[model samples]
Target: MRVPLALLMIATPLAAAKRPTVAQLQIQVKKLTEERDSLKQRLAATDSLQQDLVAAQQARDQAKADADAARKEVEQLKANLKANASGGDTLLKDLEAARKEAEASREELAKVKAENAELRQQVAAAPREGDLVMLTRDVQPARPLNLNRATPHIKASGFFASRPTGVVVVNVLVSEKGEVLDARLLQGLPGDSPDAKAANEACVQSAKNLVFDPATSKDGNTRFKVWQGVGFYLD
Candidate 1:
């Protein structure tokens, strides 16, 4: 018997198949759908992880840069501290040296002051040594009594009726050539009274009028600066 072509085609698929269970087909379809969803989730998770790693690396790089800047600043501070310490030491040494110099100057000034005081004392103690030496050389020898010198300046008026009236003392400095340089009354009656003034004047005149033999030194040379004191006594 000859079969139709359409029926042959349909019958051919049926002849090759073992009969399929409906439960097995359903299980296979479920397994394939789960595998596709699992693949999509894994891809999304990988992308998120890559993004987090990049942010962490950027933070680490910034921290490293900040650490380098801090280290440089610390080094600079250390250098500045060392420089200041050295300068302070130098200043201390200079101060000590200046102190010593000032002390020495003060000591020297004290020594100078002491020397000046001693010099002033010496000057005050012996004021007239030079004057005395000159006077000694000028004293004339008035001894050996030349009493017969007929005096024109002295006259006896039959001796005074009353006790002689006036007495005076005068000091005179004779110049180098034996001329009276100065005459002054040292002690006498005090007054503007004519009698007292006359007496004083007379004494001064007498001193000036008197002449001495030229004074001589031990070597017989004429001396300078003779001084004399003349006293007028009433008896």
Candidate 2:
């Protein structure tokens, strides 16, 4: 009862799968068509995206131009501000200079006023012209009046022309060099007549011609100023 190997092999069936039905094949075809339509929709969206990118680039260029213009405007404003500041500083300096000048002018005016007051005081304290004020006793020369070398110079012709009959005294201020610097009439005639005035002027003139010795201090050595009197008795 042993069978042949070839006949046993033929009796064993192969493990092959069954074939697909027609309806299943139709469902697969439908899915592949839907995928193709979705791919077409995505490809159409790429053109719109490209247009948006172009618009964005144009907007970016316009924004850059606006920013440049704004920057230039800001720079101009800064320059203007700096110029105004310079002008303000110059104005302040000018004001300060004017104030200093005013102060100087005020000081000068004060000095002028002080000088005027001093001059007025000096004028009040000075002696008047033709005053016969004698030197103080302490400062007078040793011989205040020296009649020697004075009588020879007197003449009758000086007062005789006026026909005056009075004594005329003249105050002569003698320098240390025995020179007569000034002569003033101390005593004249009793009346103020024309002849009396003439006689007084003649006496003053004659007194100036008189010579004298050098004046000395109380110690009789130091040269000093002195005053002398010359009398003219006219008849």
Best by TM-score: 2
Tens digit of lDDT per residue, candidate 1, span 9-67?
01122223576533333334334433432344335434554565555455445545544
Q: Locate the minimum summed-lDDT window of 10 residues in model 2.
A: 1-10
lDDT per residue (tens digit) for residues 50-106 in model 2: 565555455545545554554555455456656787676654555455455545545
Q: Rate the local accuracy (lDDT) of all candidates.
A: 0.43, 0.49
Clashes of 1: 0
Model 1 stretches astray by more than 4 angstroms: 1-166, 190-192
Error of 2 at 109 (Å): 9.1
Report clashes for each candidate as comma-separated counts.
0, 0
Candidate 2 residues lying further than 4 Å off, grouped into runs, are 1-134, 142-163, 190-194, 226-235
Q: For each candidate, what TM-score against the reference?
A: 0.33, 0.36
Give the per-residue Cα lDDT of candidate 2 at 221: 51
Alpha-carbon RMSD, candidate 2: 71.4
